[model samples]
Target: MNLYPINAGNFKLDGGAMFGVVPKSLWQRTNPADANNMIDIAARCLLIEYGNRLILIDTGMGDKQSDKFFGYYYLWGNDTIDKSLKKYGFHRHDITDVFMTHLHFDHCGGSIQWNKDRTGYEPAFKNARFWSNKDHWKWATQPNKREKASFLKENILPMEESGQLNFTGLPELDVLKNSALGFDIFFANGHTDKQMIPMINYNGKTICFMADLLPTAGHLPIPFVMGYDTRPLLTLDEKEKFLQMAVNNNYYLFLEHDAHNEIITVKNTEKGVRLQEVFNCNEVFNLI
Candidate 1:
C-alpha cells in the first residue's frame, strides 16, 4: 500500500477559534496570527493506494463556493486536488473510495462540484464510493444550527444523488468489526458526533489520520482543543486518551490540517506528550 499527501490548498481561520481558550501568547508561538488574528491552515487530504482501491480520505474545500463565501476564509496556495493527484500518476476518476472523516465543508466540499451546464451540482469523483458513518450522515443531512454552515447541501447530497454514497457500518460500537481495511475506528464526539479516526496498520507501524482531533503538531497538548469543537471539556479528555495511546504505541500522526507539518510522532515527556519528530510524506512512504 502507498499513501500520498494530497494538498488541496490553504485557507485562513481565526487562530482563537483554532486553539480554543488557549491564550494567543501560547499558540501564536507556533501558529503566528495575522493582523486580523487569522492563522493559515492547509486543507491536506490523504490518498491511500491499496490493491484495487484508491481511497481519498477527504476532499479539501472545493472551488464551487461563491467568491463572496470564499472571501471569509481567504483561500490561497497553488496546490490543488487534481494537481496533487497527478503528481502520483492518478486522477479523480482513479479514486475508488472517498473516506470522509466527517461532513464539514472544508473536509468534504471537494467531494462534489458544479456541473458544466451550471444547472446543478454533482459528485467530483465520478467513480468513487463516498463513505461516511450512518449516524454522521444523518446528522449532516439534518444539520444542527451551530453546524449548518459547515455542512453545506451542495457539498454533500450530490454523492447520494449520484448513487455513490455508502455507509461504513451500523453506527454502533462494533462498526469496525468486519472492516476490510486493517484499521480500527476511534470514535470521538467532542469535535462532532462520531468523528471516525482511522488507526491504520501498514508495514510494521501504525499511522493514524488525526483529522480534527489533533489538527497540527501544535495541538499535541491536551488542552489545545479547537474552540470550534462543540464540547471543549470532552475534547480535552479525548485528546488525553488518544495522545497517550499514540505515544505508547509510537504511532505516526498524519495531520490533516497543518499547513507545514506532514507527519509527526510524539514522546511521553515530563511535560506530557511532546512532538518527537516531523517527517515529509515521502520519508514515511519509505518507512512503510
Candidate 2:
C-alpha cells in the first residue's frame, strides 16, 4: 500500500474561531495571524493506493463557489487536487473512494463540481464512492442553525444525486477492523455528530488521520479545542482519550488543516500531550 499527501489548497480562517476561547497570545505563537486576524489553513487530503482501490480522504473546498462566497474564507495558493494528483501521476478518475471525515465545506466541498453545461452539479470524482457515516450524513444534511453555514448543499447533495454516495454503516462506538478499505474507522462526536477518523495501518505504522479531532500540532493541548466544535467539553474528553492512546501506541498523526506542518506525533509531557516531531508526508512515509 502507498499513501500520498494531496494538497487541495490553502485558505484563511479567523484565528479566534480556530482557537476558540484560547487567548490569541497563546495560539498566535504557533499559527500567526495576518493583519486581518485570519490564520493560514490547508485543505490537505490523503490518498491511499492499495490493490485496485485508490481512496481519497477529504476533498477540500472546491472552486465552485462564487467570488463573494469565497471571499469570506480568503482562499489562497495554487495547489489543487488536480495538480497534487498529477504530481503522483494520477487523476480524479483514479480515485475509487472518497472518505470524508466530515461534511464541512473545507473538508468535503471538492466532492462535486459544476457540470460541463453549467446546468447542474456532478460528482467530481466520477469513479469514486463518496464515504460518510450515516450519523454525519444526517447531521450535515439536516444541519442545525449554528452549523448550517459550514455544511453547504453544493458540496454534498450531488454525490447522492449521482448515485455514488455510500455509508460506512459503523455505529459511533464501533471500530471497523480490517475493512475492505484496509483501515479501522473511529468516530468522534464532539467536533460534529459522528465525525469519522480513519486509523490506517501502513508499513508497520499506525497513521491516524487527525481530521478536526486534532487540526494541528498546536491543538495537542486538550484545552485548545476549536470553537466550532458543538460540544467543547466532549471534545476535551475525546482529545484526552485519543491523545493518551496515540502517545502510548506512537501513532503518526496526519494533520488535515495545518498549513505548514504536515504530520506530527505527540508525547505525554508534564503539561499534557505536546508535539514531539513534525515531518512532511513523504519524509515520514517515503512515498517519493
Candidate 3:
C-alpha cells in the first residue's frame, strides 16, 4: 500500500474559534493569526493506494459554494483535489472509495460537485463508493441546529442521490478492528457524532488519520477543544483517552486541518501528552 497527502487547499478560520476557550496568548504561539485574527488551516486529505482500490479520506471543501459564502473562510492556496491527484499521477475517477471522516462541508464537500452544464449536483468520484457510518449519515442528514450550517445539503445529498453512497457497519466499540476500508476505525463523537478516524498499518508503523479528534499538534493540551464541538466536556474525555493511546503506541498522526504541521508524534510529558516530533508528509509517507 502507498500513502499520499492530497492537499485540497489552505484556508483561514478564526483563531478564537479554533482554539475554543484557550486564550490567544497560548494558541498564537503555535498558530499565529493574521490582523483579522484568522489562523491558517488546511484541508489535507489522505489518499491510499491499496491493491486495486484507490481510497480517499475526507475531501476538502469543494469550489461550488458562492464567493459570498466562501468569503467567511479566507482561502489562501492554489492546491485543489485535481491538482493534488495529478501530482501523484492519479485522478478522481481512479478512486474506488471515498471514505468520509464526517459529513461537515469542509471534510466531505469535495465528494460531490456541480455536474456537467451545472444544472444540478452529482458524485464527483463517478466510480467511488462514498462511505459514512449509519449514525453519522442520519445525524448529518437530520442535523441539529448547532451543526446545520456545516452539513450543507449540496455537499452531501448528491452522493446518495447518485447511488454511490455506502454505510460502513461496525459493532459498538471505541475501535473497530477491521472496517470496510480495510483498516481499523476509531469512533469519535466529541466533535461530531460518530466521526470515524482511520488507523492504517503501513510498513510496520501505524498512521492515524487524526481528523478533528486531534486536529493539530497544538491541540495536544487536553482542555484545548474546539468551539465547534457539540459537547466540550465529552471532547475533553475523548481527547484524554485518545492522546494517552497515541503516546503509548507512538502512532504517526496525519493531521487534516493543521496547515503547517503535516504529521506529529506525541510523548507523555510531565504536563501531559505533548508534541514529541513534527514531520512533513514526504518524511513520513514517501509521496508517490
Candidate 4:
C-alpha cells in the first residue's frame, strides 16, 4: 500500500473561529493572522493506493461556487485535485472509493462538479463509490440551521443522484466493522454527528486522519476546539480520549487542514498531550 498527501488548495478563515475561545495571544503564535485576521488553511486530502483500489480520503472545495460565494472564503493557490493526482500519475477516474470524513463543503465539495452543459451537477469521480455513514447522510441532507451553510446541496446530492453513494454500516461503539478500505474508523460526534476518522495501519504504524478533530498541531491542547464544532463541551471530552489514545499508541496524525504541517505525533507531557514531531507524508512513511 502507498499513501500520498494530495494538496487541493489553500484558503483563508477567521483565526478566531478556527481557534474557538482560545485567546488570539496563544493561537496566533502557531497560526499568525493576516491584517483581516484570516488564517491560512489547506484543503489537504489523502490518497491511498492499494491493489485495485485507489481511495481518496476527502476532496477539497471544488471550483463550482460563484466568485461572490468563494470570495468569502478567500480561496488561493494553484494547487488542485487534478494537479495533485497528476503529480502521482493518477486521475480522478482511477479512484475506486471516495471516503468522505464528513459532508462539510471544504471536505466533500470536490465530490461533484458542474456538468459539461452547466445545466446540472454530476459526480466528480465518475468511477468511485462515494462513502458516508447513514446518520451523517441524513444529518447533512436535513442540515440543522447552524450547519446548513457548511453542508451545501450541490457538493453532496449529486453523488447519490449518480448512484455511487454507499453507507458504511453503523458501527458498534464507533468502531467500523468489516470495512473494505482496510482501516478502522472511529466515529466522532463532537465536531459533527457520525464524523468518521480513519485509523490506517501502514508499515507498522497507525496513522490517524485528523479531520477537524485536531485540525493542526496547535489544537493539541484539550480546550482548543473550533467554534465550528456543534458541541464544544463534547469536543473537549472526545479530544481528551483521543489524544490519550494517540499518545499511548504513538499514532501519527495526518492533518487535513494544517497548511504548513503535514503530519504530527504527540507525546504525553506535563501540560498534556503536546506535539512531538512534524514530518511530511513521505518523510514519516518512507522511513518506516
Cα lDDT of model 1 by residue, 1-288, tens digit: 888889988999999999988999999988998998999899989887888899899999999999999999988889999999999899899999998899999999999999999889999999989889888999899999988888999998999989999887643552365355546778888999888888777778887899999998889888888988987888888889888898889999999999889999999989999999998888987734
Residue range 1-288, candidate 3, lDDT tens digits = 999999998899999999899999999999999999999999999999999999999999998999998899999979999999999899999999999999999999989889899999988899999999999999999999999999999998888888889998865769988887899999988999999999999998899999998877789899999999998899899889988898899999999999989999989989999999999989888752
The 10-residue segment with the lowest total lDDT in model 4 = 172-181
Error of model 4, residue 146, in angstroms: 0.2
TM-score of each: 0.96, 0.98, 0.98, 0.98
**Which lDDT values do the candidates have, in the order given?**
0.88, 0.91, 0.92, 0.92
Per model, state how many residue pairs clash.
0, 0, 0, 0
Better of 1 and 2 by lDDT: 2
| 1 against 2, candidate with superior TM-score | 2
Positional deviation of residue 218's Cα in model 4 after best superposition, in angstroms: 1.1
Question: Which stretches of model 3 miss by more than 4 angstroms?
Answer: none
* lDDT ranking, high to low: 3, 4, 2, 1
lDDT of 2 by residue, 1-288 (tens): 999999999999999999899999999999999999999999999999999999999989999999998899898989999999999999999999999999999999899999999999999999999889777899999999999999999888998989999988775364667655779987888989988889999988999999999998788888999999999999999889998889999999999999999999889889988999998998877975
